[model samples]
Target: MADAEMVRRETSFWRHAVVTVPAILLLGLASGWVSNSGYGNPWFDGLAKPQAMPPGWTFGAVWTTLYILLGVALAFILQAPNSGTRRTALILFGSQMMLNFLWSPVFFGMHQPRLALAIIVVMLVLSIATTFWVARIRKAAAWLMVPYMVWLSFASILNYEIIRLNPAS
Candidate 1:
């Protein structure tokens, strides 16, 4: 009986890991793609940035950390037992993630901070909604998202400031 239970637990751990590692990696990949695609472009370089803007490298570091947190939070929610809200939470999470993926292209690739700000606003709202959904299922998962929420809020403000600072951009 003891040996059977050990095997069962081990299997469960691996099962969760199979889902989690990829989720985290995928989020990291998306973050990398956005940063790489947007950074150092002529259009982005030409824009007037706010004084509050951190050094260029800081964005990559901060975003990578945030994306990892997002993945952990998502993994928890995804691994939770199937529930109706799980689906909703996943959808909301996915929507915000897609929006998150689009922000860089809109802001730097297309040189449209104004539009990016708009996208971030919606993304922020969806993120808050996702947090709530995850909270209902797994408090740890929800807590994992707190940093992401804070960062998104900060990013939204930064986007707004960029639009204001560079009206020409």
Candidate 2:
């Protein structure tokens, strides 16, 4: 009977994990689309990018994967039993998500690469802290945030380069 209960609990935990991926992906897509709609298409093509700038397709692919991971991490945190650590984790997670959502608008829609770079730096720091907090509850949750942190690091560099190359943009 005890073994059966353990199995049931594990199954419940996994069910939440399975649902998180799609929910996060959808949120990512919605935010991306909303920001994309406000920006002028010609602006992107006309910008003077640094030589190191990635192919246009890469941005979408990388963000999609990171967003999925973010979703899973969040789901794990949500599943944790109520505790002070869980509350802090939720706050950190939500803060980073808000920052992530704002990035597209600042960079593409407003055409402020410098500001975007600054925002990304903050986002990176917050994400790292959030990862640490989540690790306290679930190590896998913390590990899941690694791709996002790495991607933001690269993005910050790219944003700085763009600001340097396109001073007038």
**Could you tell me every candidate's TM-score relative to the true structure?**
0.84, 0.89
CA-lDDT, candidates in order? 0.79, 0.83
Model 1 C-alpha RMSD vs. true structure (Å) is 2.9
Give me candidate 2's TM-score against the actual structure.
0.89
Model 2 root mean square deviation, Cα atoms? 2.3
Give the distance in Å from residue 143's predicted Cα in candidate 2 to where it truly belongs.
0.8
Clashing residue pairs in all predictions, respectively, total 0, 0
Off by over 4 Å in 2: 1-5, 37-40
Q: Give the per-residue lDDT of model 2 (tens digit) for 100-155.
A: 88888777778677888888999999999999999999999899999899988988
Worst 10 residues of 1 by lDDT: 30-39
